[model samples]
Target: MFMNWRRIRKWHFLRLISMCCVVSLLMVCWEHVDHHVVSHMKSYSYRYMINSFSFVNKSLSVSQEEAARFNSFPYLLNQNNVCKDKDVLLLLFVKSSPENFERRQAIRSTWGNESYVSHELGVILKVVFVMGVHTDVTNSFLLQDLHEEHKNYGDLVQQEFLDTFHNLTIKLLLQFRWMHENCAHARFMMSADDDVFVHMPNLVRYLQDLRRRNVRDHWVGHVHRGAPPIRSKNSKYFMPFDMYQWNSYPDYTAGAGYVISGDVAAKIYQATLSLNASMYIDDVFMGICAIAAGVSPQEHVYFSGEGRTPYHPCIYEKMITSHGHENDIRYLWKAATAPEVQGISSGLVGKLYCTAVKMMLLCKPYFSNTYSCMAAFT
Candidate 1:
C-alpha cells in the first residue's frame, strides 16, 4: 500500500509539471505573435484593430511599417490646393445602409441639394456628406431591429463593418484635402451617422457665433458623463464572450454626431501617429486620439440617444438639435410642428432653460476655452 501511494504521488507531480510547461510555451508563443505581427494593419501609423474573427475569412491586420507612415501626419497634412480661400466646409460622414433610403431622403429634404445655405450669420458652408458605407451583404454578426421594414436591406455588418469603416475614414481624408482647399471652409468638420438629424441651420449659427469669438477646440457634441465604451456582447462593439475578461468602454466618442474644428481635425489627424491604440468603436477611438492631441470633448445642449431617453418639449425649445428618437419625434412633432396637439413649446419653459444653463455652468464650468480638458486631456 505504501509503495503504491508513493508511485501515484510521483505521477501526479509529473503531470502538474507538464501542464505548467505547456502554459509557459503558449504564453511565449502568443507574446511573440503579438509583438512581431499585430502592429502592421494600418496604412497610416495609428494601430487599427478589427475583431479577430476576421482572421478566419481574410488576414486583415495592419503592419508596423505601414503604421509608421503617420510620423509626419500633421506636417504632411495635405492642405487644399486653394488653401487661401476663406469659406466653411461641412464634413458629414454617414453610415450608409440600403434600408435607410427614407431617412436619407428626409435628410436630403431637410438640407436640399445645394449643400450650403448662405445666411447673414455666415456662409452656411458647402456640406460634403461622405457616406461611410457598410454594404457588402455577407455579414454574419450584424444586428438590426426588424422594428422597421424600411431598414430591411441593411449593409453587410460583421467585424468587417468596423474594418471597412475605419479604412473609409482614412481614405476620406484624401477627399477632405481636395475639397477643403476648393471650398475654403474656415470653421468646422462635422462627422456623424446617417441616423443623426442635425439642425443644420442651428449648428451653423452656433458655429458662426464661436468663430467670431475665436474658439478653436471644436470637437463638439453631446457628452455622455462617465459613459465608457462597453466591451460585452450586449454592446454593438462587443468582443467575444470568452476573448477578453474585461468590461466597460474606454472613455470614447458617442456615435451620434460630433463636430471638430478644422484646426483640431488637423491636430487629431497628426496625433494619431504617436499614440498606443484602442479598439474600433470609432467614436471612442476618436475620443482617445482627441485626448492625446490636446483636444477636449464638449457636451452640447442638444445631442441624445438610446430611444429610451427623450427630450421633453420644455427641453427642446432651447436645445440646438435633438437626436430624433421616434417616440419623441412622433409625439413632439405632433405637439409642436404638426396640426392638432397644442401647447408643446410653452413660454415659461424658456425661463427654465436659461436658468438651467446658468445653474449647470455654476456647478461645472461651461465647456468653453476658459474651462478646457488640457490638465486631463489624455
Candidate 2:
C-alpha cells in the first residue's frame, strides 16, 4: 500500500490539471447537446444576418436618427402621436393611403357582411398605420382626449403632432401599454395589423377557455429557435444581431401578430420604455422588450401567417389569431363564409382553379377599386 501511494504521488500536478480540463470541456459539450437542441425552422440564417448588423456603426442624425431608429424595418408608421383606451384591443394598420381605408369600408359593407363579430369573441380597435398617416397624426390621435368633457386619454397622446408614428409592431404594443396604464377595467389587450385576418369568434372562445384554466401569459405568432438575424435591405423586415446575446428570447409572435393579457402587455410595455431599438424588425424589438420585462414569451401554437388557412381544417382548432398579407384581408372572409363549404369537407387548402377565376370575375365590378377576392370571395 505504501509503495502504491508513492507511485500515485509521483504523477505531475500539470498532467492532472490537463486531465481535469479535458473532462470539463467534454462535460460542457455534453451539457450543451442535452440542453440546447437546434430546431429546423428556415429562419436560422436570418437570425445570423441580424447579429452582423450590430457591428455596423450607429451614425445617423438626431432627427434622422430618431426616424431611422424608430423606422427600423418590416412595418411602417404614421407620425401621429396619440393615446388609446386600455380596455380595447387596438388593431393598428399602416397604409400608403388612409383613403384606402374608406374604400376598405366599402369592401366590408359589400362583403364584410359575412364577418364573424361575436360579442364574446376577439375585438379590434383598428387605427391607421402611423407611417402612412401625416406627420401630425398625433394631433388627431387626441380626438378622444380633446373632447375631455367625455374622456381624458393620457400617454398615447404624447406632445407631438409632427412625430412619426411608432412602428406598427411598436405602435400596437404602445397602444396596449398606454391603455393598460390608463384603463382600470381593461382585462386584456391585443395588437395586430389591419391586414391580418383574425378569427375573432374562435379567439374569444380560446380566451374564455384560457381564463377558465387561469393562464395569463403573452402569446404571439410563435417561431421556435429562429436562426441568427439576417441583414438585408431587400427584405421588408430584416434582423441584424448575433444569436441574441441572451441564450434565447421568448418565442416572438411577429408584430403583425397580437399580444394578450393586460398585465403582461403592460409589463412588456414598461420593459420597452428604456430598451434601445434593435436592427431586426418586430421579433428583435419583442426580444429586447421581453428580455427587459423578464417576461418569458409563451408560444401559442395556433397562431399562423397562412391567411385564409385560418378558416380551413384548423377552423375547429383553438386559435388566437393568424397573419395575412396586406393585399388579402378580404380573402379570409370570402374563404371562411363560402356558403358552399358550410358543412362540406374542408376545401380551403385545395388548388385555385377556374372557379377561383370565376369568383374574381363576379367580384370585379365592385372590388375593382380597392377590393380583392372573387365575387363569391365572401
Candidate 3:
C-alpha cells in the first residue's frame, strides 16, 4: 500500500513537471509564433478585405511628380532596331548584371539562340539583355568590354544607374520603357533573369496557341498569393513600416521569370508612370502596378518559383522556366530539348510512364517550389 501511494505521487510530480516545461516553452516562443502564424492570418484577412473592396490601387497610389523620377534615367546603351522589320512574336528581355558575360554567352549558344529559334520554330523571337552600369569604381574597365559586347551582339540595353539590389525596380522600368518605345508591336514580352532556363520550343508552342486565341491581358508565371512581408532586418527582402506598412503584398508572380502579352505590357508601363516606384522589390512593385491597371496574374504549373525543378524528362517536357541555372544551362538545354523528349509523351505507354514519373517526383508532403502534384495528371 505504501509503494502504490509513492508511485502515484511520482506520476503526478512528473506530469506537473511536463506541464510546467510545456508552458514555459510556449511562453518563451510566443512572440515568434505570433509573428509568423497570427500575423499571417491577420495579414491574409486584411488583404482579402481590401482586395474585395478594390482599395489596393488607391492605397498604393503616389504623386505624379514622385513617379516622374522613377524612370528618368537616360539610356547609355540602346537597341532601337531589334524588331525593325520582323513580325516579332516574342520580345524576351533578359535582366542581366553588367558582369554576367558568361551567362549571356551560354544563353546565346543554347536556348536563347535567335537563329536556331527562327529556323526551328519559324517564329521571330528577339532576345535583349537589360542592365545598369556597375557601381564599383574598380569595375569601370568593364564599361569598354560591355560596349564592345553590345556592338558585337547588338542585344544589350543599358541605362545610367548603379546596378544594386534596390535598383531592381529601375531595371524593371527599363524593360517596359524600351518595349513601349521600341518593340510595342510584339505579340508578347518575357522578363527573365540571366540564370533562368527557358525551354524555347515548349514556350513557343504555348505562346503560339495563345496568340491564335487572341488572349489579352495575359500575365502568367509562378504566382505567390497572400505572401506576408518580411519584417526582420536581416532578410534582404525586409519591408519596413515606413516603406510598406501593409501586412500582405498584393498577388504577384516571382520575378525570376514571367510573361505578359503586348497589351498587358503596355498597361504595366502606363501603371508604372502613375504608381510609386519606391517599392524597390521589383516583383511586388509589379503587383502594385498590376492592381492599378486592373490586371491579375495567372498561375502556370510549369513556371518555377525560387527553386529549380527536379531533373527529369517528364519535367522537361512541360517546363517553361526553371530558376537558379547559373552553371548547367548548356547541359540542361541539350537534355531538355533533346529530340527524345518529344517521344516521351506520345503514345499511351509513354504517357503513363511519364505521368507516373512526374507523380513520384512532384507529389511530396513538402513543397518543391516547382511543378505542383496536379501537374503530373496534366
Candidate 4:
C-alpha cells in the first residue's frame, strides 16, 4: 500500500512537469505560429468563401495615368525584326541579367538554338534575351560589350531602367509590352530565367498538339495555390502589411519558366495597362495580373518549381523545363535530347522499370520540387 501511494505521487509529479513544459513551448512559439499557421488558415478560409477575385482587381487597379509610368521606359536595344512577317510557333523570352553573358551564350548554343528547333522540331521558334542597363556605375564598360552582342545577334531587347531586384516588375512589363508591340501574333509566348533548361523538342511537340486542337486561354507551368505571404522582414520575399495585407496570394506559377497562349498573353498585357506593378516579385505580380485578367494557371507535372530535377533518362523523357541549371545546361541538353531517351518508357518492361525508378527518385518524405509522387505511378 505504501509503495502504491509513492508510485501515484511520482506519476502526478511527472505529469505536472510535462504540462509546464508544453505551456512554455506554446508561449514561445505563439507569435510564429500565429503569423504563419493561423494566418494561412484564416486566409484559405476567406479565399474559398469569396465569390470571385474581383476584390483583388479593385485593390490592385490604378489610374491609367499612374499605370503609364510603369510602361513608359524607352527601349535601349530593340529588335523589331525578330518575328516580323513570320509564321512563328513559339516566342521565347529569356529574362537574363546584364552580367550573365555566359549563361545566355550557353542557352543559345543549346536549348535556345533556333536553328535546331526549326530543322529538327520543324517549328519556327524565336528566342530573345530581355534585360535592362546595369545598375552599378563601375560596370559601365559592359555596355560596349552589350552593344556588340546586340549587333551580332540582334536578339537583345533592353530598356532604359536599371536592372535590379526591385526592377523585376519593370522587366516583366518590358516582356509583355514588347510582345504586344512586336510578336502579338505568335501562337505561344514563354518567359524563362536564363538558368532554366528547356527541352525544346518535347516542348515543341506539346505546343504543336495544343495548336492542332486550337486550345485557347491556356497558361501552364508549376502552379502554386493558396500560398501564404511571408511577413518576416528578414526574408528576401517578405511582404509587408501595408503593401499586401492579405494573408494568402492568389494561385501563381513559378516564374522560372511558364508558357502562355497568345490570347492569354494579350489579356495579361491589357491587364497590365490598368493594374499597379508595384509588386517587385515578378512571379507574384504575374499571379496578380493573371487574377485580374481572369486567366487561371494550370499545373504541368514536368515543369519544375524553383528546384533542380534529378538527372535521369526517365525524367528527361517528359521534362518541359527544369530550373536551376546554369553550369550543366550544356551537358543536360546533350543527354536529355539523345535519341535513345525517347524509347526508355516505350514497352511493358521499360514502363515498369522507369516507373519504379521515378518512385525511388521522386517519392520522398521531404518535398521534391521536380515532380510529385503521383508522377511515379503515371
- Using lDDT as the measure, the top candidate is 3
Over 260-364, each residue of candidate 1 has an lDDT whose tens digit, in order, gives 787887776655544423234456556555655666677654554322223344333334444544223334333333222123433568455544543443234
lDDT of 4 by residue, 99-204 (tens): 8999999999999999999898888999999998887746767988898998998899999988988889999999999999999999999999999999999999
Q: If scored against the real structure, what TM-score would every candidate get?
A: 0.53, 0.51, 0.91, 0.91
- Show model 1 residue runs off by greater than 4 Å: 1-65, 68-86, 111-116, 119-122, 132-134, 137-185, 225-231, 239-250, 273-278, 308-313, 324-378
lDDT per residue (tens digit) for residues 109-130 in model 2: 3222223332323443433333
Pairwise lDDT winner, candidates 1 and 2: 1
Please provide, for model 3 over 105-132, each residue's C-alpha lDDT reduced to its tens digit, 9 standing for 90 to 100: 9999998999999999999999999999
List clashing residue pairs in candidate 3.
none
Model 2 has a clash total of: 46
Q: Which stretches of candidate 2 lie over 4 Å from their true place?
A: 1-99, 102-132, 135-173, 238-250, 278-280, 306-320, 325-331, 334-378
**Which stretches of model 4 miss by more than 4 angstroms?**
1-39, 49-51
Prediction 2 TM-score vs. true: 0.51
C-alpha RMSD of candidate 1:
15.8
**Per-model CA lDDT versus the true structure:** 0.45, 0.43, 0.90, 0.89
Instruction: Indicate the residue-level lDDT of 288 in model 2.
Output: 51
For every candidate in turn, the CA RMSD to the true structure comes to 15.8, 16.5, 3.7, 3.5
